[model samples]
Target: MDSSDATPAASAPRDPAAPTALRDEADAVLRGLAGETARLREDQWRAVEALVAEHRRVLVVQRTGWGKSAVYFVATALLRARGAGPTVIVSPLLALMRNQIDSAARAGIRARTINSANIDDWDSIQAEVADGLVDVLLVSPERLNNPDFRDTVLPKLAATCGLLVVDEAHCVSDWGHDFRPDYRRLRTLLGDLPGGVPVLATTATANARVTADVAEQLGTGAENTDALVLRGSLDRESLTLGVLQLPDAAHRLAWLDAHLDELPGSGIIYTLTVAAAEEVTAYLRSRGHTVASYSGRTDDAERQAAEADLLANRVKALVATSALGMGFDKGDLGFVVHLGAPQSPIAYYQQIGRAGRAVERADVLLLPGREDEAIWRYFASLGFPPEDQVRRTLDVLASADRPLSTAALEPRVDLRRNRLELMLKVLDVDGAARRVRGGWTATGQPWRYDTERYARVAQARAHEQQAMRDYVATAGCRLEFLRRQLDDEQAVPCGRCDGCAGPRYDAAVDPGALDAARAALGRPGVEVEPRRMWPTGMTEAGVQLKGRIPADEQASTGRALGRLSDIGWGNRLRPVLAADAGDAPVTDDVFNAVVQVLASWGWERRPAGVVTMASRTHGLLIDSLGARLSEVGRLPFLGRIEYAPGAEPAPARSNSAQRLRALAGAFTVPPGLAAAVAAVDGPILLVDDRVDSGWTVTVAARLLRRAGAAEVLPLVLAVEA
Candidate 1:
């Protein structure tokens, strides 16, 4: 287990007895990785041989809890002992990298990571790797596409790497449930690897189609034409799958409160969104259960500590989003309960697979929510933009004299920050653009926008989503159905799921617990952080604004009655705010909730006047909200900010920068409104149906402030958390 041992040279002569000795050594490594009593399965050895002995590309498609990590760790030990260069692993999640490092140490392979979370140590880690003092280097796939790292460090690693491992390899395929553009860039790394260097791709979730795509990518441009795919049965014999249809979010949380004790030892509780995850974790803790929340919003240090808590069984469960999936090792995890269905069956299978790895039996339950489809649709909306949008971005880059940062590009394009960066990574992979020191630049590589291909990908995603819906409603054996969805060869009825064995868990919730859940969730109010800095390239977008917004023009910290993603009010808001839904006047409950939020809010000063944003589709809704506030609070009612008399209404925008640009000219102070605003000796409350990007509110508040309002305080019916 010492870190000082060096790998033998790849060209070293082999003894007749050396193969047996290496196999024996690998067994010892497995024992160390899985504790002293463990042994490798036959399939695990097959994978190890393909990577270390045969020096061939391998793709391992196995069920979760099948010890996929053991295959790589054991092979790394064998390869390092043979004097090969250190193994390089592209992991998708920080949680995965952390688990890998700890597991590698037990197998006597020294491992280090280079990720955004640990910037202070990256220099030292690279120095150690160059000196051959490290055995395994685990990094996120995003790092592979990082401009500096790609231009400087990648070439050397490709040439000298002993083995290349792509964990969660399904991510490389657009057809995969969790496809990431950065993962697709791995093909470039594979193509550039030295001829003799072996590679391995591993995933628990890929179906037959994704397997083919990933395997082809793994074999790309190599001397080898075919990747050695070692596929295994997807059946997890220890899992008892079931689905509980909950009537509402209140009942769902209440069910957990009533039933946490009935489940076995520590496990995971999965929710579809970050808000749901946090809400569920809080409710569970309030009910005296030991649990922690895991999501993208969780800080690195807190996430690490939460992981440790779950691993050590100090907490009963971790309420998490997909952020906690992929390479998290907990063999004895006793259960996995989903608060809502995942968008696809592959994702569901992969999540539930996290349970029942080491134990004889583990519980897997799904409390399918009525609003799950709405959540899924919202996520689906963020998929790759239409061809014209991509072309618009490329045109901007191609026309620009200098590379522009993402922030600068934001104002020139309609894409949001997250999706914009993702598109750039895809372009970088396709050679349409290149990310460099300054930012991103068009490559002028005669790239054709693949509209047909993208369309087909979109179609495939729709099919996956439909498949997930069927999963929740199926009457057949859930395990067998899930296995078939993954194209498992051993797909057959397990006779242990709720469909086959009858409902295994009661669906009822105590009346008291349900009431308490309703009370907790019904409590509303979320703070909206004010926009401090203007987005870059505002001047180029024809808005003269730049740098930090003037202090006087900024709106104060605002409040929304509730988030659209909340487990409570979110259910009530989704239908009304839906794209196709017609506008309806505010309901009594909604009006009361808004009033309650205002009463509880302790602002520095009370508003003396009310102003409303111009509502195209929700005029009645906005007017009613503004009128009610004015009458109840004893404030003067200022006219709404409206479009200029004959000016064209700008089309609806989907991103902040673009929205701000359009709103800059869309609204003006109606003649009487300016004088009414000048009459206001106190802050004016700016009312809106909802606050999405906060750009509309910001622009409107600035106009009112310029007209003579002392201050602007924003209030909205909902916030898109």
Candidate 2:
């Protein structure tokens, strides 16, 4: 939370005379304060000064509770005294802004926020900002993108613009723990300002790659920047890391109950999902532990109440998602229990960093299970794009010399826009492509693909899995393995882990017990076939007519099915019928694509359609067709009139009606053709009359694929699809 409560370490401090240019500027600013500025450590003061004096753009990288805000607060005061005008601070969270504004008010400085609550009065705020009534203005990047504010309010403030500070600057970098697209536009917006405002970027965490990205996004080239790289010693010697590989959720809860009294004064239990957070909190409550739960989905007032309770120690332990600790300051947290594996090392560290803030010994307990990895794998699979799709996308980009807009290139690629965007980002990370203006460009260099990134994300995950194998498989010290992963040198053999705890604890139990239990619960077996059919049904008769209808003439039918079926035609018919054709077997790929397409549309096979009628006869025969010579035409690929008979009108309908019907026609093809198309094993192309909703098609395709269809393709007649 603050420097007063930070743990003391043995790391050497930077030299006092080590290029103190930035230090001198910060000192000058602090000296101008009317009242005493907050006292800071020598190292903190020096880092702040160097940031102010030397770097036109500086990135402050410090650990939590390291007095980061003091550096900027001092600089702001000094700048205002020297007639540098008002400063602007951009943050992503409104709560963080409110906290900073409150802190500044306590320090006797004027600050105001231009967030959702007060944005309606922005015009008047702009006048105050222009008149120098406001010393600092806090706003989120989303609001800054507002056209009116950019065109009107920003220009007025530019006259006295002194500093452009971005807090939590790591959000600007894609590699950062939290990446936001709105942050990307800030560089462009600020660059357009009348005066060249110097920028300062600050964050508690950033690796080398993230640092470089932050510089680029801020439009500050690396050559012109200075970094105050403070390596927060990872040596939290007072904290013990314990990992348990439980057999099931019940077993994990049992372990928690056994260790309840052993837990420190107050603790935070982190869960991966909102459901888990609620479940764990309820379980704890039932067991007589005062607990509170916090998650993103919880209402704001409830979240605030939970946070207040946690801080007041009214709740002995708090079960929460990763959202509880941002900008929060609690000095006496004793333990951080991870209910499941976190996504990454960065996330784990951020959560664990909440504990031991008061320089006291603490504990971090990690409880994982066999199904945890499967859960993580499922999420990873969802995030990863199919290799074939990625390759196809890459090939399309490789063929062009210029970058392509994602929208313009969608038709040229098979993958959806959002999925494609993620794939491109992954490619960029792998150096397969470099993101350019508006799109991505191939680097013409092959990337060494590492499948590990596609697996578990956190270092803790890999460590824990290995530890589990070593303890349960090879019989080793679990505590030692955890200490090794955390870089702890003094970890003695703890006689606690299953391995060290001896035969009674290490006796092998059937790992398949949970699976057996699940099996006994009567879980339904996989049903991919039905799933595939429900999304996209087949009609062979529909196919024959599809080939017969001209693309242009079909385009205006209002529905794709209507265009293919000639649903509303009257009796003034010139029957140009095609002979019966036999059904062909469909391939797996075609079936899958079609299933996907059908799933996209909400169509399923029913007993009453053309396919059902054809199936009853075991084959298809020639029906009837006609052509009208009207001005309206169908699309190019609807079908072709390779040959048609010049037949006379068959019914009482007048010739005028036939003339008015533009190329309206129909045909009867074999029932097997539609069946074959539907039955294709691999993938499917879904053809629909009209796409009123894409969800049905998507769902159907997913079901079909699960049912053993290789692929599904959806072809919809209208844009509604």
Scored by lDDT, the top model is: 1
- For residues 1-721, could you state the per-residue lDDT of candidate 1 as single tens digits? 1101211112323333437666788899998887888877767876786688878888888888777788888988888888999899998878878887888888678999999899899889999999999999998888988887897889889988999999999999998999999988788898899898889888999888998898778878788667878887788889999999989999999999999988999999999999889888888888899999999999999999999999999999999999886657788999999998888999998888888889999999999888788888778878888888899999999999999999889889889888898889888989999999999999989777788888888898888889888888899999998889898876899989999999989998999999999998898777877788877888999998889989888898888888888888888877777767888788888888889988988988888899988887777888889999999888889889987666565445456778778777778998899999998788999999888888888888889889998889899888887
TM-scores for the candidates: 0.95, 0.53
CA lDDT, every model vs. true structure: 0.86, 0.51
What would you estimate as the lDDT of candidate 1? 0.86
lDDT of 2 by residue, 1-721 (tens): 2222322222235454655555555554444432355355665665454444443455665555565666677767766766777778888765466567766776556888787656577778777887789888987776654556655666665545677778878778655665655576566555554433556677765655666666556653334333334333333444555666666565566556556656887879887666567666766676677888887768766866776787778988888877664555565778888867764455565677677667566677777544445445434444445566677777877987787655545545544455566667666645577666556687878865455654433443454445444433445654455444333344466565445554322212343433332222211111111111111111211212211322212211111211111101100000111113243332333233333433344434311111111121112211111011000111111111111144232222112112112112212223444344345433333333223223334333333334333444443322211
Highest TM-score, which number? Answer: 1
